[model samples]
Target: MKHTIIFLFVFVFLQKGGLLAQSDGDNFLNNSVKTEHFELLQEFLSIPNDANYPEQITENINWLSDKFNELEFNTAILETEALPLFFAEKLINENLPTVLFYMHFDGQPVDLSKWDQESPYNPVVKMKKGEGWEKVENPDFKNLKEDWRIFARSASDDKGPIAMFLSALQVLQSQGMSPKFNIKVILDSMEEKGSPVLAPAVADHKSVLASDYLVVFDGPMHDSGLPTLLYGVRGITRLRLEVFGPSKPQHSGHFGNYAPNPVFRTAELLASMKDENGKVIIPGFYDGIEIDENAKKIMEAVPDDERGIRKRAGFAKPEQVGGNYQESIQYPSLSVLGIQSGWVGKETRTIVPDKVIVEMDIRTVPETNSNRLIELVRNHIEGQGFTVLD
Candidate 1:
C-alpha cells in the first residue's frame, strides 16, 4: 500500500509535464519504488522516535537534515520551547509559489509486551496467512505485492509518507525534473505530544516558514484504499476531570455505606453527558453545528462500508450521533480517552479510592469553538453538582 501511494505520487509529478507515456511512467515508477525506498523506510523505523525523549528526536532531526541536504535542500533546525523542529527547502525559482509540506517524525510511546513483534522499531514485512500473518524474510523488493504489510510503529501514521516524499524527490532528481513550485518541508518533532510547541515555533519562524499554500501529510489513507484529498479536519481539545470523595482511601468494608465512592460520582457525571445513543446530551455542546441537505448529500456520496467498519472495529452497533459514518464526524464528539480510580486486575484492593480521574477529548468541527465546548462541559459537570476546579 505504501509503495502504491509512492508510485502514484511520482506518477502525478511526471504526468504534470507529460514527461513519459502512461506505460513508460508506470514501468519507471515501479522500478523507482524498489529496495532503495524500502531501505530508507526501514532505516527510519529503526530509530526510536518517542517524543518524550529529546535525544531520540535529535537523532531523527539529524537523520532528516542529512537526507534533505544530500538532495540539495537547505535545511535548518527551528528551536522551540520543547523539542526543535526541522525545516528544509529547495528554491526552484523566486517567482514560483512556495508549497510548505508538514510531516511529523515523532511517534507515540510503545509497550513492548503488547506488541507481537520483537521490537516496534524493528520493522518486518509480512503476508496475511488465513487468520494470522507470517513474516516474509528478506523480501524480494522487486516483487513486492500491494497486499504485503509492513508492521512497525509510525509505519503508516507518518514515517511512511516522509520516506515516500523523499523517494519522490529522489526520482524527480534522477530524471532531471524539477517541481513547478518552490518546495518547503517542515518535520515536527513533538506532534505525538499534541504539538504543544508547534504554534509558537510557527509564529517565531513565520517569515522563514511563509508559503503560498500548506499541505499536511499526515493521517491514514481512505478506507477504500484509494487516493483521497481532505479539505478540512476536526480540531481537538482535552479535559481532565478529577472527582473527589474522602480525603484518603477508605476501606470498603468499614465505609461501605458511610463514605461516597468517587468512582460512582465520576461515572454518573460522565453518563449525564451522553445518552445510550452516544450523542452528547449536554446543552449547547453541539450548538451552531448544522448539516444542511446539500452538505448531507455530499457526505453521503462517500464510499463508506458501514458493515466493514463495524466488523473491523469489532462493534455490533455504532453511536447514533450521525445517520452514517460521514455524518457522525460532522458534529462535535465527546469521547472518554481514559479513566482511572483504584487499581484492578492483579492490583485490586477493597478500598474506596480518594478520587477518580477521567480524561476526555472533544473533537470540534468548524462551527464549534474549542473553548466554548470546554466551558459547556464544565457547566454540565457543575449542573450535576460537581465543582469543576481549574
Candidate 2:
C-alpha cells in the first residue's frame, strides 16, 4: 500500500509539471521507490509512535523536523496542552494558492504477545502464502512483488504518506523542479486517541495554518484499488449512558424478580432509539437531511459492490436506512459501540449487576448539529422515564 501510494503521488506530481517529462519521471520514480523511498519508510516505521509515551512522540517529531529541514522546508513545533504538533511549509510563490496537507504520526498501543514479529515497531516484509503471510527474511527491493506487504503500525495509517511526500520533494529537487502551489503540512501526534487537542491548537494557530485548500492524506483507498477522492466525511460524537440499579449486587436467586435489573432498563432505552430495520427512531434525528436527484445520480455512479460488501461483512441484509449503500451514509446514524452489565463466559456471576453502562457514537452529516443530536438523545432517555445525568 505504501509503495503504491508513493507511485501515485509521484505520478500525479509528474503530470502537474513538478517533475521531468513522463518518460524520465517513470524511471526516476521506480529507482527512488526501490531505494530512497524504501529506506525512509524503514527508518520511520522503526520509531515507536504510541502517543501514551510522550518521549517516543518527541523522538518522532525530531526525526520529522530533520527530514523537513533537509528538504529546505521551514519547520516548527506547534505546542499544545498534551503534545506538540509538527508543522512544515515551503513557499514557492506568495501569489500562488497554498495547499495544506494533514497526516498523523501517532499509532495505537501494541501488544507484543499478539504480534507475530519481535516488535510491532520493527517492520517486516511478508508475502501471501496459502491462507497466511510468509515472512520474507531479506526482501530483494530491486525485484519487489506486487503482493508483498510491509507490516508495521502507522506504516499506512499515516507515516507511509509522509515518507511518500518527502520522496516526491526529493525527486523534484534532484530534477530542479518546483510545484505550482505553495505547500503547508500539519502532522498530528495524537490522532489515534481522537485528537483531543487538535481543535484548540488549530484555533490558536489559525493564521499560520491558513491555506486555500486542505487535503487530508488519511483513510483507506477504495476497495477497487482505484484512486479515490472524498468530498466530505461524517463528523463523530460520543455518548455514555449509565443505568443505575441497587447500590450493590444481590444474589439472583434471592431477588431475581424483586430487585430491578438495570440491564433490562438499559435494553429498553436502547431499543427505543432504533427500530428493527436499524433506522434511528428519535425525533428530529433525520431532520434537515435530504438527498436530491443530482446527489442520488452521483452516489449511484459509484461502483460499490453491494454483494461483495455484504459477503465480506457477513450480513444477510443491510439496514433500510437508505435505498442503497451509498444513500445510507447521507443520513445520521446512532450506533451502540459497547454495552456492559454483568460478567459472562468464564466470569459469569449468579448475581444481578449493580449498574449497566452503554457506550454509543453518533455519525453526523453537514446538515446536523452534534450538540443538538446529543440533546435529542438525552431528551429521549428522559422521556423513557429515566432520570438522566451528565
Total clashes in model 1, counting residue pairs 3 or more apart in sequence or in different chains: 0
TM-score of each: 0.96, 0.90
Q: Which stretches of candidate 1 lie over 4 Å from their true place?
A: 18-27
Compared with the true structure, all predictions reach lDDT values of 0.88, 0.88
Task: Report the lDDT of model 1 for residue 196.
Answer: 90
TM-score quality measure for candidate 2: 0.90
Give lDDT tens digits, candidate 1, residues 89-166.
Answer: 999889888999999999989999988889999999998888778899989887878779999999987998999999
Supply the global lDDT for candidate 1.
Answer: 0.88
Which digits, one per residue and each the tens of the lDDT, describe model 2 over residues 1-390? 556777788777777445233334446655656666788888999999999999999999999999999999999999999999999999988988899999999998898878888788999999989867899988877777888899888888888888888988887787667788899999999998879899999999999999999999888777677888898888889888889998999899998998999999888889999999999999999999989999999889988888888886789899999988889999999999889888999999999889998888899999999999999999998999998767
